[model samples]
Target: MPPVNASREPMTLPRLTEDPVSPLSPGTHTITVRHGLSRIEQRYHVAGTGPVCIAHPGGPGIGWEYLRMPQLERSLTMVYIEPVGTGASGFLADPRAYTVTTYAHFLRAVIEHLALPDVVLLGHSHGGFVAQRYALDQPERVEALVLYDTSPVTGEEFWSAAVANLERFVQRHVDERPEVARYVAALTTRLDQLTDEGATAVLRTIMPAYVCDYWGREEEFGPARRSLRMYAAPTRGDGQPFDVRDELSAVAAPTLVLVGSDDFICGPHWARMIHQGIPEAQLTVLDETGHLAHLERPEEFRSVMTGFLALEREDAH
Candidate 1:
């Protein structure tokens, strides 16, 4: 993959930032922290007094903004953050520096900095990978794990499907706008060059295709479409090839793996695999839904999550 934001100059941006429409109640104070010279920062949106839940974005570089997951925020004090190189967070100059382990470390830092206990991690897509890894590494820190539309890990076996889908997605976008094919190709190729910061720029340009068939409200879809476009600029020429299947047993947290029944990307079967791997995990297949289950069916998503959280609360009591 090529770099999405490389074409533009790299500047030092705010290490941590706040969301304009935080799901947390007004007057709540959230903190952002910068650790080390790298631009990897964490954004905390604190509210509610029950337990702490950290929300990780999916794309390797996409920030937490795309996922408002307001339902979860309303129930628990939620912390949404930009991965190493996306959003208001600074980008690592080294593209190789962008790996799942480092991202998980950053997540740990956020949890420790906030001094949160009984932390429940809710990660979507790529973020799920992070949450899974974090649980495996720091099982004691995590109270529960919510894997939203992602597998325990991904590898050569899964790359074929992802590659095929991405190729089709890119082809469709290029077909929609032939003139931009070269740019699209270039951007996708540039995915590798992207330090984490460049990932957001790339996603903003190319992520829309995934949602072309998902959202009903064009108004709602419009912003999502724009987000996809930005991320599209960075291409994974060979795609990502890493597996965490062996680490599944290491996750001691009670896990809940949710999937959209109609998710073309990470379907229900994948969710089942996660449930089977994590001995304590529960799987829920959301019928008639797609990849963006939270956005597509917010109310149902909220209900499912709330029920799970409530269960955990009861068990704790």
Candidate 2:
């Protein structure tokens, strides 16, 4: 994979300048820290009042708003991050330097800046990729991990499976919804080098397939799609393809692999892969749902998550 941001400027690794104490107040905050000689402002929103759970949304681009679990917030302090290069977070000088390693490094820096000894890390989609990398890189810093709707690898095989699954989705709906084929056919959205509007458009176009019953239950999920905000960051590519099958065993954090059974991309197959890779990991698959399991079944999702969190909290003693 190539760098999406075309700037030839130098890239710097994110590092902490000082041991800063930041309270997790109910609001959004930005932390500007050293990224080599450059600086990257880490942006995050805090809500809720229980044990802290750092939630990382996917997209390497999608806004963190969609990943907000209001139900979970009732019990868990949700720290939703607007990853660098997206939203108000400072951009990397060399956008091409974006990779799982880089993201994990920045994530660790931000975590350290927050002064939390360890964190319950929840990552969805591409955010899951970053979480896995971070867990492997700094297992001691991760109190627990939630790998949601993500895969440990990304390449031809991974994408081929997604296409096949998307085709299946198209076939399933084409008979009833004649326009399903058009929606699937028009999905020529480039995975790299996307602008904010372009990323949002691409996601909106594919939302039908991304969620198992998105279109069927439009009234319930319509507001989500209409209010979707995106800030396209550079694709996470540092010349090598993303894969962590062998490295997964190194993750010491207790992990919960959660996914929607009907999720075309990063479905049960990947979930099982992650579950099996991590030692004593738990796997929970929500049936009839797609990528957005939390959105589709908020109560059930929150129940399972809080249950897991409670158990983890107990074991922390």
Candidate 3:
């Protein structure tokens, strides 16, 4: 799909292969799993080949395509989860049930259904919150953890700091890139009101700020912005805001904290907090990058990931 304006001709997508030796065999797989009393469809795309790595994409409402990592896929079998309410996945009966904990429940089912006694868990952005909760709640299941472009907690402090940083970013670009102010405004607006299609439009416009230099590299990243599919997921919840700062120290799996230095929301501040909280955690701050480090600097991101995974595997022996 190329942008919202483009026609989405109905087309077929791949499904789980028949009579596979292992469920993780390199291809698409869809399984209906239990999350409490709710029967949900957990559809995941499989690619690459190596140790099983369950990659959870963010957006609680956003589509999973943006998190695709052909780079990391080379060394790790990337199982890209198309989370609930997204394409091919079942929707929640109670929209309010779309919290991180609910997501973790479904994620656990996916791992269990795959019969993965231990698997590497990678979560990005909102998905990171889910990963942390999942890893913290069930430490034994996860072999290692990758928390990318996310924060340990998101509450008053997180929002206030992000607003301050985003204001700075807007002011910096106010003179040269006048349109950035508009984009920033759109980004901060009452996003909860936006429909799924409306969310897609807003996300495309604000996609530039997500990178260190989107306009400079528009040719490279423009396609991603245009093609981004978004669903308006329940963001503002009545439940307590995501906070795992205190619980991070108890995390058993070796963790890697990845964040873009210039990321307005999950910048150096939160990344540092996460680093300090997790004992022996490796923190990689990609300078001159924003929210999407993998998109901004694929090679560097991939190198660090592969290196860390290899080291962890070596240490396991």
C-alpha TM-scores of all predictions:
0.75, 0.89, 0.91
Model 2 TM = 0.89
> Best lDDT goes to which candidate?
3
Root mean square deviation (Cα) for candidate 2:
7.1
In model 2, pairs of residues that clash are none
Give a tens-digit lDDT track for model 1, residues 187-284: 33455565444555554454443443523455656555544413322123224564677768778887889988766567676788888787878888
Backbone atom clashes (below 3 Å) for every candidate: 32, 0, 1
Q: Give, for candidate 2, the lowest lDDT window spanning 10 residues.
A: 1-10
Residue 277 displacement (Å), model 2? 0.9
For model 2, the stretches where C-alpha displacement exceeds 4 angstroms are 1-22, 185-188, 191-194, 236-239
How much does each candidate deviate from the true structure in C-alpha RMSD?
6.6, 7.1, 4.0
Error of 1 at 311 (Å): 1.1
lDDT of 3 by residue, 1-317 (tens): 11111111211223334334567877667788877787788788787778988988886677776777777777888887878877778887777788888889889888888887888999988888989999998899999999998888887888778777768888878798887877656766665677888877887777766778777887777767777777765543334688999889999999999988888877788888889999999999998988877677889999989899999999999
**lDDT-based ranking:** 3, 2, 1
Angstrom error of the Cα, residue 34, model 2: value is 2.0
Cα lDDT of all candidates, in order?
0.62, 0.77, 0.78
